[model samples]
Target: MLQSFKCEACKSNNQPSVSNHKDNSHLPDCKDEISLNTIGVIKTMFLEKRAVPRQASEAARIISRIELNSRIFNNPEHSLEGLETFSHIWILYYFHRNQIHLKSKVAPPRLGGERVGVFSTRSPHRPCPIGLSLVQLDRIDNGTIYFYGTDMVDGTPVLDIKPYIPQYDVPRKIERQEFFSPREAPDGEENCESVKTASTSTSGNLVSNVTVPNWVTNCKYLSVTFNETAEQQLQELAVEKKSITEILRADPRSVYLRTKYGSQIYTFQLGENTVTCKFDDQNSIVNVLQVRKVVILGDIPVSDDE
Candidate 1:
């Protein structure tokens, strides 16, 4: 059975904009309430609170699935019409983990602990805890969207999904990228086309496509060849070069840590294992030295560092 309804209580503008200006002042707090429906739930390998990536870019190889709510689960063939044409899709979801707190300002590590208005940054502690992410569309089968590049947690309530169209979405030219911070575009690097955000959450309240910085694409990545021990062990598990590329390219570190640590051992929690590597800034290579099983504390797999 197909069902639909019109909501006039809280009107939302879906058009893309530089800033989100939602006028909620008119509605009285005493009587105003807006309810949103959950269309699906996202299934991911990231189970721990800290295990998830800060943004979709870091989750390039992270395969996840979106299973539509059984209420709307019937007839995937009709519901997912014309969606296969696009290579990427936008996912709007609720940040279930961020419901505990809300704040107006936060210290963003990207700026070395500088305080900024919460609205200006992508911190999870905001007025609204909605999260938006762009991911590679693998294929939709039996009403499940199997995708890569997810930044959300397990059991996330998905509100909606939309295909990505580059023609209308990408702007021809920009007057100035003043909206971007200096840390995003360094002083002497070629004017980077895109920027990598260390955003923790979103306000589907205001959402858009995820764009990776051109610098990241152009950055030198040394050929990754495993040591004899690593190669022998990896063969048993059958890991691919493509998976390694996807994981390392998206710098997996806190904004504050990635900025100061020139040469250090960084570990990432992927699935049941912890990948430990040393990043060589001079040559711009990540040498994956070892992979070990993550220790379970409570119900989540934890890295030794944590």
Candidate 2:
């Protein structure tokens, strides 16, 4: 079950030899650069990389489907052996859109564009562009894996998959290594104090032994409503009324966008349609102004089978 409490601070396939990505400091004495290939590709609602949720948790209920490269991931019937036994799986993929370069320092949204070491944050601009995510395993059918809670953009290259064993993945007791505490702004409740940081400790880790502030694990989202035209269009499309709401409630803005343009009319790709959302930061209300089917060239224009 989803639990709520505070004190925060947190947070491919191909089957080919992945490039060894060293952090800001690359080992000059180590081997040369390596080559990595895509094991499979993924399909998500995000047609482009504009308003993607920074973390998978921000878009938990959004469904994403993954297909392996048949040329490499053969034996479809047996490929996902014993995968169904677990409730979650790890997705390893490449940042196909990442440029061919590396940066020692980056500005993270969480720190309001504060310059921090590339190794200190999850920025894609790294020595090697790779991604790892843990998603709830909805089910597996044929050679495809259907799951929820993905931050991947459409057509993401998935490299590998592995079952999640609690004993091996989940720690018995979590040490307070995180520097964040959740922000608690509730109905008739004001959010307590928060201290966002981009500094590392002398020991080469994030701020250790930091104070965790009271944060909100969940918030009541304003029930999204549509106009007459949008309502009729939504009914015709057979889209759930809650699907758009969930994304808004999760606050699609990255830490940078939120700090910069929280009141702007945020537009994002939703399936084959475009959704325009205007959020009221004070009351936590999201207004769905428009939902129109758009022509996205890279969009998968069709539904998946099996």
Candidate 3:
């Protein structure tokens, strides 16, 4: 059943080997490739990858819609019969915009540009360009599912949708206490601590303690402010101040941009318009400057009046 070995061609024993896999009929016989098709296409205000939030929770105010493809289902409406009962759903989509390359390590924004294994962080540039997000289900109409809290860009190819059932999805807490050595802990985890003891539950259903890096648990949010001119522009455009504040609080900038272009004007597209702002590094605040229509005349961006 369980086995570990390397191919004959590999010279080093240090080469990656597959192990601990219990061979069974449930496992597919396919050797190299697996085929998948798009089930639907998602529409959202994030027109570009740079503008999309880093996490769904960061953009809780935004709503996105998934238009199911009829060709993928015999009767699309019938397929979604029992899904309306759930308040949340998991969306598995393809990261179509990511560049074709793999990196062993990545720098997470929260860590102040420290490198970590790619698997440790939710980077889109993985071996398989797939994304997963749990969003609050707003409503379901005929072949469309509208949900809030989206980090996906517009026109994303959705692979599947599954209802969020807590009992099935959430892992059971440990009914018994246990401690692990620092070597046993995950890579980012340093201190050895005791696992939480849970109330009496069914035997063999509980899981060991889960530990996350301190940086993940303690996130830093930037204070957002709007000038009189920016506030007036937002009012004129009928944009919610809270929506802009939520996005800016998350500080949606890559580490490279934040480091190199620290003093440059920060701009991101919101709907059909572009929002421009400045970061006050000394005060850790984001001061919104203005919102302008994204009209391009050659390389120059023109205002709505122009």
Candidate 4:
């Protein structure tokens, strides 16, 4: 005999319960595996997606061009014939600059120090680092499709392009999340009161002849002095932290105290700045000492003097 049950939510009594059902081994594997490289590569001028905006709506009026391969271009017109009617198109591309191994949890810049699940964040580190951008389509001529308001970095490879449909894509009402607040402008504008004119050189460098903003000029710990060994480790840490921290305590060779004289590795975490070096290895420290004025070249790691 078969058993019957009631629906808890609606209080209906027509539903059947499976508490006494016998198991049958007739189910097949449900994994659907698709082959990769099924689609051809899309060559574009964008290289890295980090420089791309977190959302496509943020970028407006930025022009970018997409070119398809000759094979795909043979019938490109047929594939994109009616695409121009749509105001916006969805661009799917690969993130070529993801360095860290794909992780399920990522530290988003907006979250400060908190670690959020990768699915909740728009992190590039995923099973496949694919990016989606809703770009404004300007025109399509031959195999080239010109777009505007693109956030993709120069030389980024595009994967696919699909026209955005308002009827299907637009949401009725979006529930707000805690971290969905708009970004605020920096508070340094108040300090710009004394600023007169800001000019840049032909080489694209800011040539500031006027006095710096009061916020920056009034900083007491602007200049940091460190020994060669300590300076090197600080440089390494600066690259990782992307911010400069003043060194408060001074103890030369403090980082190398753990190891014997020959194999000593010295490192120090000064505020947000971190420096690392090996005993007798002064190459990294020497480079940091040379740039005392500002924390320049923080991205590149230097070898310690050996």
The candidate that wins on TM-score is 3
Tens-digit lDDT string for candidate 4 (1-71): 23453235223433234433355233222334543331234333233332244444544544577776556
* lDDT values for all models: 0.65, 0.67, 0.79, 0.48
Candidate 4 lDDT score at position 30: 31
Which of candidates 1 and 3 is the stronger one according to lDDT?
3
Predicted candidate 1 versus true structure: per-residue lDDT over 1-306, tens digit per residue:
112222332234333222332563434233345688899999886664553666787668878999987787667557787677668899999888776346678865445466778877666666778888989999988788999897877889999998764433443333255457354334334221232121112223123544544432454334444556555545655655456555565455566665678668876655666667777757767677766656889987675547
Between prediction 1 and prediction 3, which has the larger TM-score?
A: 3
**Candidate 4 residue runs with Cα over 4 Å from true position:** 1-33, 38-50, 173-306
- Mind giving the per-residue lDDT tens digits that candidate 2 earns over 1-306? 123321122111222121333352532323366676677799898878876766787778888988877887576647886777668899988878878447788876545566777877677767878888889998888888899887788999987887664433543333465436454345323221211111111223323443432222233444555667667767877776676776776666766667777777887777777777787767767777767776534734422210
For residues 1-306, what per-residue lDDT tens digits would candidate 3 score against the true structure?
A: 225554543324344344533554433333466689999999998888875788898889888899999999977888898788778899999998887447888888888799899888888888778899999999999989999998999999999998775444566654335344124445334231222222233224544555678878898899999999899988888888888888988899888888888856888888778888999766789999998777878987666756
TM-score: model 1 vs. ground truth:
0.62
- Candidate 1: what lDDT? 0.65
Candidate 2 stretches with Cα past 4 Å from truth are 1-30, 174-232, 254-262, 281-284, 295-306
- Write down the TM-score for model 4: 0.44
Task: Output the worst ten-in-a-row residue range by lDDT, candidate 1.
Answer: 196-205
TM-score of each: 0.62, 0.66, 0.78, 0.44
